[model samples]
Target: MAASVQRLQKCAVSPTGKHTASVIFLHGSGDTGQGLRAWVRDVITPELAFSHIRVIYPTAPARPYTPMRGALSTVWFDRLKISQDCPEHLESLDSMCSTLGAVIEEELKAGVPKHRMIIGGFSMGGAMALHLACRYHPDVAGVYALSSFLNKDSIAFQAVEQRVAAGQSVPELFQCHGTKDDLVLHQWGEETWSVLRKAGMAATFHSIPGLYHQLSRPEMELLRSWILAKLPPDGP
Candidate 1:
């Protein structure tokens, strides 16, 4: 384990004695890690055995997001001045990449192999997860992006394309979006899914019709199962 990993004061749940896998989840803008914890407690069922795995709900650093005119927000990256589509602030995207990178690295140093770790998030956090999966942590088991689109102009996306061209492994991706999502239009998610799939990533996308910008029951179940599917058989 990395001796440098301490003071990771976020909402987390771990098996009482031992754990072999890790899941880091990022919350949407303006929402704290506690929000994700609530979802676990209130919505998630025990059948998933998530309690046996290490789950982390990391809160984003408070910063002035550019699209939000540098207003302080708990956001992974800055957005567009108007819509939730492409053309995210490049600088902010880099910062988010770095932040997520550190988290993945910490888990790696803690003896979790790249294939045993999963990174994901909701909304803006989900967007950041997709960026990291394509760019930073290609070896990660999979990525779960809920109602989040890809970051436009991501250097990681370009790099991953090059790697894939060289026949490298691409991270498995699971994405779902609400068709009625106005915050981040479902069309954008669909388009991103197509781009990634065509690029050779083992990707899946689901469109929840008539749903808004929120987590539905089916989506939650899908996320839980997706994580289980990506990892190796559980360890004792």
Candidate 2:
């Protein structure tokens, strides 16, 4: 684990000065924020073209992951023990959500409106992003979760339901998962999409045939197009 970053304490700003929108992509466990930031360079092309879109890659807090037998890594939470359901560590979940909320608030205070901010991530990161978007932050542009699962019984569900009942437009979503993903089964993502849709969320799930616990180029292409549609460069 790297001792340099404790969390997404810093925002990775785009060189394009006149930014209109912002995105924060969380990396999977074991990956560093700096590494993911560099990797995203190819995904976000034409720097000048995307000048108005600021993208951030946040570093998760370093911690001992349960599944990894206490091995320390940059993780969103500590999975105490697993069963037929999602990770069950309410305290950890709450703390991680607070950390994520702080990041979102920072962006909001920095002049990025809630509607122009998009959040998503991969694996554990994806799970946290989905958790935040669906339960806590509902004013974002859209959520793009990849290879992740959601904790259905979270207390946040009530808030999400209330938001819908109030007729407020919540963040739209595009969830991507690999059919062959063994770590976080594709079914988990599907179930999450189903629950959100049943709750009246504008969300969709895409299942890539042969992808596993990793990202695929095709998946990125889909995400890119979806993002472009959500926040067009010409849009104000």
Candidate 3:
């Protein structure tokens, strides 16, 4: 057992002189916020240069990988196995959800409108991003998930159902999964897509051929395009 930890740090880039949109990047397992910052840099920053968008990268708390030996990493929640669920994992997911809610509230306090904020991540971070977008009240502008899995067994489903019954549309979602991903099966992504579609959520699923459990250049490009499309023309 290891001591519990908190793994969220924020960075801001307001180079255009006006606060436009804000992107919060969540990192995957075994990585820190700084490690995943480059992914956003290559595509997001350049595309939004004129729009003056700001980026925030948040780290996940360190935790031992339950199914693997001699491994520890920062994770939004634990994935015990490819198709297994655990109560502890659910609790951790709840904690991350609360943390994200606080982050959104803080962004509002900082003057960023709900529609101007996008939440995205890779792998485990991607899972967390999907969870947050589906469950967050008032919804977010968009959600991007790269090489990640949706928590089919989590409490997010109930939350989303409640929101839908109230006549609220699910937030826009852009998901990218590598067909060759071995860690999180490609089928998981497809199944998740099916569930979202059945629930009447607006979701776009992209299956990248010949890619693995990591993001490639083209995938990053797709993400950039999606983000741009979700942003307001003048700056949001």
The candidate that achieves the highest TM-score relative to the unseen native structure: 1
Kindly list the per-residue Cα lDDT of model 2 for residues 58-88, writing each as its tens digit: 8887788888899988888777654326545
Q: Report the backbone clash tally of model 1.
A: 0
Model 3 lowest lDDT segment of ten: 1-10
Per-residue lDDT of model 3, residues 21-127, tens digit only: 77777888878777777655664445324345677777776767776663776777776664624433676777778877777777789788888888988887877
Runs in model 1 lying further than 4 Å from the true structure: 1-9, 46-51, 82-86, 151-156
Q: Estimate each model's TM-score.
A: 0.86, 0.85, 0.85
Pairs in steric clash, model 1: none
Off by over 4 Å in 3: 1-7, 39-50, 69-72, 84-88, 233-236
Candidate lDDT scores, in order, read: 0.75, 0.75, 0.72
lDDT of 1 at 210: 81
Model 1 per-residue lDDT tens digits across residues 1-236: 23432333377777554677888888888888887778656755652355456888888777787667878987777766535345667777776677667777778788888888888888887877887777778888888888877644456567678889998997888999998888446876777777778778888998887879887777888888888777645742
Q: Which has the better TM-score: candidate 1, or candidate 2?
A: 1
1 or 3: which has the higher lDDT? 1
lDDT of candidate 3? 0.72
